[model samples]
Target: MMAGPRPNALSWLGLSAVLVAVDQWSKWLAVSRLEYGNPVPFIDGFWNWTLVHNYGAAFSFLSSAGGWQRWFFTALAIVISTGLVVWLARTPRSDWRSALPFALIIAGAIGNVIDRIRYGYVVDFVDWYVGTWHWPAFNVADSAIVVGAALLVVLSFKSPDTTGKGG
Candidate 1:
């Protein structure tokens, strides 16, 4: 007997769309309701809703590099997101381990790219801190990227199944 056609993970794009919508909506809310550079406390000395803009990559890397970084980052995001989308199309539908991460990273990359193209900067609002030490302010897209990348890293270490059973 011949094997039938295999299902692809393209359906998981729905998750990406939902995530992008939520990311964009959150950024819109932050822009509309919060004042730039001001911290609105969400938790006592631990968290805040602070509106800020980042012109570069993670943790504001290269953010101050004269005007070119905006287009550079935007193009980079487009390329990365495009590649992941292609990967998603090739992935098997049953491989949630791979599909989930690809979907999340795609959503995040596209989400930030939209901001960069429209506003010349990525909108950031969430702020976490401890005492005087503070982590960088980031948005929903950044969170998704972080989680997705982390999952990819963790899953990469899974040992192969020895019993010939697909895992």
Candidate 2:
């Protein structure tokens, strides 16, 4: 009889849970404590807490598309989250480099999905950049997704499994 594949060591689900909790808590704080567009400086020139609602994808991609984007984004998020969960389950726990990113993406997707389902948009804050060239406002969930993507890109290049090697 062959033994089952070794289970993953890292808890991708647990990491995802933590990301969701932190992301939601941060959004709650932003909504309750800050008024929209009003900057509450946290680092004077580097960071600020400014509440904003995004009705579309990254950088407000479809925010001005007249309103069809709400459902579109919602559906996309659902699909992405589902796919991430499935991938995470199949990934070995020892593959933290890959699994963590998937977990973060999953958490971020679910977090934004909650907002879209509840308010038809995602709440964003934590602004950064120079005086006239400000980056789009975003929340903890967005941050996780971006960081996770970057990490995934880096890991893909480093991992032989991802690079398609066999011996």
Candidate 3:
């Protein structure tokens, strides 16, 4: 006897679309309203809005490697986003743990790819700091990617119950 047809998580793409819209809108607003390199304090000492352009990967990796990094990162993001979409297609609809993260990552990857293709760099604006130390400036896309990747890591440890009795 074959198992019944299982629904897939492709519907989760809706969430991806919403997140991508938000990421792009926030980037646009930042580019329109924020001054480059000038920080506008949000929380006095902990957060600020500072516009910056990233020509490389996370933490501005390979940012100074001249001009080739732009296309490289763009292509890389496209490939990764494609893979995540395929994975989501194969995942069970009930598995929100996997589906949610996959959707988040897809949104983030596509959002940044749009920036790279249009501007040759990703727009970053949010800045967080404490005292003299500060985290690298980033945007909504980066936040989604980080949160999605972190969810993947944390969820990986949750093992499904093998016993007939559902836990």
Candidate 4:
């Protein structure tokens, strides 16, 4: 039997809303409560809260690129988010494994874009790592993006016959 109408659009919008809310809230709290680089340990060495402003891409790729990267990254995010929205709209909601990741990525992208536009940088917190090998500071939006990307990688490996085939 043919599948009913796809719920991709609804799922995308719903997930995006959740991401946006959580991302914004966390950023707000980070800015209001945490001082820059002052680690507020949650589990002492495993996790901590700290505020950081990233003006460039992941791991501060263009962070020291003489400041032009701010607008460049912002524009890139807008373009990417637009494309993801279109992709999400075209995808069938029944394909949850695929659509869900796309929605998450789109939401995460939009969340960072909002910060870039409003604050000129993304506020990062929630540091995690071992003794000295600290992971770069990041926020909820980054987490969503990373998770979504991981899901996409997993979905990419799934057999076509297995996807969207209810067990």
Measured on C-alpha atoms, candidate 3 has an lDDT of 0.92
Q: What is the lDDT of residue 33 in candidate 1?
A: 99
Model 4 ranges with Cα > 4 A deviation: 1-10, 160-167
For candidate 2, write residues 94-113 as lDDT tens digits: 67777878888888888898
Off by over 4 Å in 1: 1-4, 159-167
Model 3 RMSD to the real structure?
2.3
Candidate 2 deviation (Cα RMSD): 3.5
How close is every model to the real structure, measured as TM-score? 0.93, 0.90, 0.92, 0.90
Task: Write one digit per residue (lDDT tens) for candidate 4, span 2-47.
Answer: 9786565546678788889999998999999999989999999799
lDDT of 1 by residue, 1-167 (tens): 99997889899999999999999999999999999999999998899999999998999999999979999988888898889888888987877788899899989999999999999999999999999998999998999999999999998898545454678
User: Which stretches of candidate 3 lie above 4 Å from their native place?
Assistant: 1-5, 161-167
Superior by TM-score: candidate 1 or candidate 4: 1
Candidate order by TM-score, decreasing, is 1, 3, 4, 2
Q: Which parts of model 2 are misplaced by more than 4 Å?
A: 160-167
Poorest 10 consecutive residues by lDDT, candidate 2: 158-167
- Local distance difference test, each candidate: 0.92, 0.85, 0.92, 0.85
Angstrom error of the Cα, residue 52, model 2: value is 0.6
Per residue, candidate 3 scores C-alpha lDDT tens digits across 1-167 of: 99987889999999999999999999999999998999999999999999999999999999999989999999999999999989988997778879989999999999999999999999999999999998999999999999999999998899744453543
